[model samples]
Target chain A: MIHVDGLTKYYHDLCAVDQISFAIQKGEILGLLGPNGAGKTTILRILAGFLQPTAGTIRVKDYSIDAHFLEIKKLLGYLPESAPLYHDMLVYDYLDYVANIREIDKRQKLPRIRRLADLCGINSVMHQPIGELSKGYKQRVGLAHAMMNDPEILVLDEPTSGLDPNQIVEIREIIKKIGQEKTVILSTHILSEAEATCDRIVIINRGKIVADDRTANLKQTLSDKSRIDLTLQNADFASLQQKLGTINGVDRLTPIEETDHHLRVSISCQGGVDPRAAIYRQIKSTDWILLEFHQETQTLENIFRELTKES
Target chain B: MRQVLPIFRKEFRAYFVTPIAYIVISIFLLVTGWFFFTTFFLFNQANLRNFFGLLPIIFSFVIPAITMRLIAEELNVGTYETLLTLPVTFLDVVLGKFLACWGFIAAMLIPTAAYAFTVAMLGQIDWGPVAGGYIGALLLGAAFSAVGLLASALTRNQIIAFIIGVAICFSLTLIDKMLFFLPRYLLGIFAYLGADFHFENIAKGVIDSRDVLYFVSVSFIGLYGAHLALQAKK
Candidate 1:
């Protein structure tokens, strides 16, 4: 539904969003995962048509963003980071104002507002002043405001940053539900939020995309080497290393600790290899009783830190 | 044009949503009323010349306070991003806010009609100048509101917008008054630039094309500057 090609945005001398390109499929929930100053918000802002790119092209549907931004904007529901709202207006009034601005049909306005209020879980505070509401409620109101016109594409910049854990869960559930029908793109520094809510994750660092894939695929593909933890009885470090080094898939072995009668070792295995059986046979012949053997699978959090951390 | 209406409605309604519209209008009426009544008692005259004369000076301060928050508050609160991303041109946003601020100022001037009625009841008052004076007040308010909006667009802080707006309007209000201090050749140019000069001419019921054109030019330049400021984000 959205195609961004070699997009670059510079704020004076500093490039906020460097040359980056990505495509978002319809009805897919995509997460822009990055830390502060990683240009995740910049990319979202460019997609929302709030800022023009210094270079390159963005097309939503068939229309180019530079020439047909208004049309693209009509199809997008953008909730900026922190969701700046009119403090003087009530939640209901604020939504009404947004609906009017979005140019919703007069007859459909009330239903649309009510539906959004419900979906955003802000129905209870509809009459309260937005400024007086809690941070969570205010964010919900912002969500409703964005979805006022029932836009086809939803672009949210750090939607759950300030919310409490429960509010975050609630918002995640709401976004998950919304993603069933709309093409959703949200940016977050929270890895767990992205893992739980997004179908695909794009890791951006220093204004460039570092990795882009499905959450599980990214974790699997980035973790080419696997490590097996082993604890053995009556085993010496040198003998155990010599034995494991001869195995076909074992790349390297390091002794973790040594007790009087037992040794614990971490074995690094080459990618796409399982040497557990060979090590089991070797250990069976040595009379060194195998106490524990487990392979560690990489988590998304580890993959994220590895990709985005100082390199 | 259609997009301007929603923004205009929201902005115009926003004035009353806060205490700003009521407070500004009340203060304006009280100060202008005090000036008019005091001069009426002192001069024992039925004319509203003193009232009209005090307005351009009053607007130099009042209009800024009224318009300072129009674009400045949006920028401060980060609503400018939301407003700009909507399916409306920057011109629509500028025009909508300008009209709302101008409309508020116009509404504030509505009660002053009583002063005109009272002057006629007390003695013969020239309706021509009275009508021209109201027209002049509207034109001056519109022009000052545009200038204030330009200042508002230039800063996110309301106080800074007000200060910049007042500085510009204050200069225009009194620039002609400083002509005596200038060299002989510069007087005409300064007088032509002075808001008071055109305001005075229209207040006298002459309705000169030059004065009308002056207000239009000032208003256009101010609004155009504001439009450019809005588009600078692009």
Candidate 2:
């Protein structure tokens, strides 16, 4: 578990992370979502013991970052955005080095390195120079290095940045699997990825935490106005639109497309009502074949844009 | 101490894998060997007097060239973040890198022993002076390397590290010669603090504790400055 209080990091006159406080529970997958220059990486760096906050306190597993840095570092693993790898070292060699530096016992180092390499799916690249590998392989190697010592906390900065779509999904699954047992704080700008992978989301903007809540709760809170799309055959377009507009919950109805036999309409509802039943009753009296009706819920992408834009 | 050893081992291995250690040793042997063949053989000196006397001047440039990339390259490539975030302390990282460079200098010196062997084979070489000269050269190389490491820590640019290292080493080595241009009252005191003053004393077949202490102090100061620089960043 990690606790950060009043964490403000200033580089001279510029504040990178400003007075942000958040606590992460053990075994929680916390997604730090923000656009570029949104202080996500800065917050992660301060928590990882790489940067000293100008005015704040960070505690990792009850060890103060200021007083017990070595112990705190022993409990946390940080993977920077760039993967900070030695180009000339082989994958195994680099992990071995990380294991040794993390103070894993000499006897356990090899076994741990092998286990992590297997877990991160980097076994085939173990003997190859890291610089020679592709971006996906390199990111996996970085993840392996972070997991080499099996630290209790993992702080990853944009772990899926440079990978292809398939690689991103694989890496996200790996991170989720790892998060099941360890505390994970992952920083990313991709809203969908965070929604798919994290247990809770913390949206940051301009060096401040704008929103923090469970993914489902956040979607529910913002899904007040739902839109329903309907397609019909042999429907009177103007009559259907006018009739649907008169329903109690239906706020607006607009024709999306019209053909000789088929008409597509989008209906907006007010006050979180299900307008499909009312629309169905109104169209029952008309000579129209109702083909499709589906409600559109609010997505994490829309909520992210709305929240970040408010800042 | 446990963390220091792994860092030391990795840094030592890095020098070998990156061709830095090899190039340094090869250049040192080639240049020193050339100097010996040309200066001593042509002049026909029975002792390795010229060879040992010239080592400090050679080390002034060679040691810095070897140590310029020790920490600066890590900063340049952003690996310093990885290094600092580990459980290792600042002292562990500094000592590990310092010892690695010292090890490389030692390895480079090993081949130069052949020159000592050649001189011993050719004449009645005084083992005392030869031993003294080796010690002096090793200390001088270490001091130069430490200063270079400090300069490297001040910047993330390896080229800038190399240039500053060379400049510092040149100034330290040539400071004694600059005494003639200084005010007469301060000339002796300034010369006594310069590297050449102390190195010459050690190379004269004598183990002066004061001269030994001088090299140790200089090395300590340089490494201490490097430690402070890294600590400031953290």
Native interface contact recovery, model 2 = 0.77
lDDT tens readout by residue for model 1, B1-234: 678888888899999989998899899999999988986978877788889999999999999999999999999999888777667788889999999998998899999999999889998888898899999999999999999999999999999999999999999999999999999998899999999999999998889999999998999999999998878876
TM-scores, each model vs. reference? 0.92, 0.91
Residue B182 lDDT (model 1): 96
Report clash pairs, candidate 2.
none
Question: B28-58 in candidate 2: lDDT tens per residue?
Answer: 8888888877878777766767777677678
The most accurate candidate by lDDT is 1
lDDT of 1 by residue, A1-311 (tens): 89989999999999888889999999999999987999998888888888889998899999998889889889999998988888888888888888887889999999998888878888889998888999999889888878877889999999998999999999999999999999999999999899899999999999999999988787677477678999988889999888889998899998899999888999988867788899988888887888899998667777778788897
Clashes of 2: 0
Off by over 4 Å in 2: A227-270, A276-296
Badly placed stretches (over 4 Å) of model 1 are A222-269, A272-296
Q: What is the TM-score of chain A alone in each candidate?
A: 0.86, 0.85
Model 2, range A134-247, lDDT digits (tens) per residue?
A: 999988998887777787899899999989999999999899899989999999999998999999999999899999999889878878867789999998777886777778
Error in Å for residue A247 of model 2: 5.7
